[model samples]
Target: MLRRTVLLTFAGAALGGSLWQGAAHASEGRSPYGPLQPPDDVGLALPEGFTGRLVARSGHRVAGLAWHAAPDGGACFPDGDGWIYVSNSEIPLLGGASAIRFAHDGTVRDAYRILSGTNLNCAGGATPWRTWLSCEEAYRGRVFECDPYGSRPARPRLAMGRFKHEAAACDPDREVVYMTEDEKDGCFYRFRPTDWGDLTEGTLEVLCHGMVWKEVPSPAALVKATRHQVDDARHFNGGEGCHYADGVCYFTTKGDNRVWAYDAKASTLEPIYDADSPLSGVDNITGTASGELFVAEDGGNMEINVITPQRVAAPFLRLHGHSRSEITGPAFSPDGTRLYFSSQRGRRGILTDGHTFEVTGPFTI
Candidate 1:
């Protein structure tokens, strides 16, 4: 078994649970999991006692509607005793978000579209209000707030910003939404809502030196790029994924292969993992109730690496085939016993062959 002791643990109640795991959680890093077994029937290599199951496949009928291709960022939402896993489709023009209703016992109850008619719907964050922020990863893209239950119609949150958006992380304590841009010279941003839980209007600011905030004169960037609108905005090398737990916000920079930790309370930003670290090609990210971070690789060894609370990072699982594919969404179930993610390009290394998988095992809390 691999384990470590964290030097710092957040206060308050963590109960140690999951984003559909209830997404980012605060808990001690104490995992009692062992090494990977062999590659399973699904071509996935997981740890001992952990089993993988196919939850959805691209271009296939899940419930009735054909599943979307190129599944990207996703989160689990609690639905009664069961839960719903919402995923983004990365296909241009047809890009949107979909949801899979799961029974308490992990059975697929239904599958349907939540958001549609968007472009390049990539990674996004889960809000405390049970809404999924589906981001569009294209030029002048926007963030769409979709209901996981598929009841309410999805709305475009134009005030958030209009750039090549990749992902978002909601900081409820501070009532801010942290976002990442997927450009070579992208800038990290945060939107402060005019009212708590409201996304229609807000002040969009970019993160500057010393973790300070600098107001972005424009969000739509019709005249100038949003990253250039702020004079002192800190530049990141292609930011991809963002997640928040306790008071710390963790995000990934794909170009630099770095995982950043932004201490909201302390007002500081630092890299927790870098190019020399164990993981590479870090893309989509998520955390467990035990406070362990799960980072999916975009091009490396096709592995999902785990970062312990003590900051020890290592690979937890790897896919055997599909070398051309990159791992996207890495989320957990509400009970924290099961994990969900997708291979953007599965067996044939194409968008239409994407696969969303579920892995169930005994995870430490």
Candidate 2:
């Protein structure tokens, strides 16, 4: 029998037993669960003003998505006016790498099977140079920079190292890139390009503190060591979703239910938000035009949480059946007027169907 779960309330009580206790407690102050309505089974819900329509469906194991602006704006460019690039982590059990592009109107414009026979087509980030870095989250992981516009072929940036990479973010202003490892005791990494606009060679370092896990040096030494050394010498937890702002970067950890901010100047890791807040189950996160932060929840009660500058997380949008849906990709339009995101079905289970959607809002805090 298919079970139905009421997100804001029951899911909060249940998640309170696990890693989301903080979020549960925080939600108590607000009406975390909204009114139940039609289409609840599908896991989608919206406020009175906003509406959501299915843009593309069943697009070959779609995961991460990046939205490019249309030269001449008419609509949000759902089909193919600009370009909608999707990552195929696993296609029909083939276990390879592939990407597809659609016209502003959702027509299949072009496709590329960049790397064949690979596993785990997880989330990736866009560069200031206008390229996509698709990360491979497997043993001996690697990061590939591919030209979605077809200017360059997809190839692994060897200087970025090989490990269980989750997501990659580039700071165009500094010619430096940041990467995260998806391991139980993974480390955060930074790549400094030898030349501007060229990522051929650079130094890699893990984050480390005086005697704590400040940051590791690049070309990390993941040697086996004691628990103290591992904690102090190494960074840990499930590293996922990275975004760059002014001079700091933010990343998520599914295992810890925590999000961290890395200050470029001070070179430190400070906690930005935690799952203990009202926005628990945060999976992937991105920034908005007004500088607010939005996060997607992977667990049941599928909803997007918005974090205000005051550091409070409120329910942004409730995807009716989102618990069964894995919300992965969240990117804003070039004008920042529209937000595009992708949802994957059966990632934690069986069944591999993916779809994309465009959301517009009055964006009130």
All candidates: TM-score: 0.91, 0.74
Candidate 2's residue-wise lDDT over 18-124, tens digit each?
A: 21222222221232223323442334576545556655455433334332211000111133345544443523223334445655544456654554454565766
Q: How does candidate 2 score on lDDT? A: 0.56
Name the regions of candidate 1 deviating beyond 4 angstroms.
Answer: 1-32
Number of the predicted model whose TM-score against the real structure is largest? 1
TM-score of candidate 1 to 2 decimals: 0.91
What TM value does model 2 have? 0.74
Pull out the clashing pairs in model 1.
18-21, 18-22, 19-22, 19-23, 20-76
Model 2 scores worst on lDDT over the 10 consecutive residues at 68-77
Clashes of 2: 35
Cα distance off (Å), candidate 2, residue 301? 1.6
Residue 292 in model 2: lDDT: 68
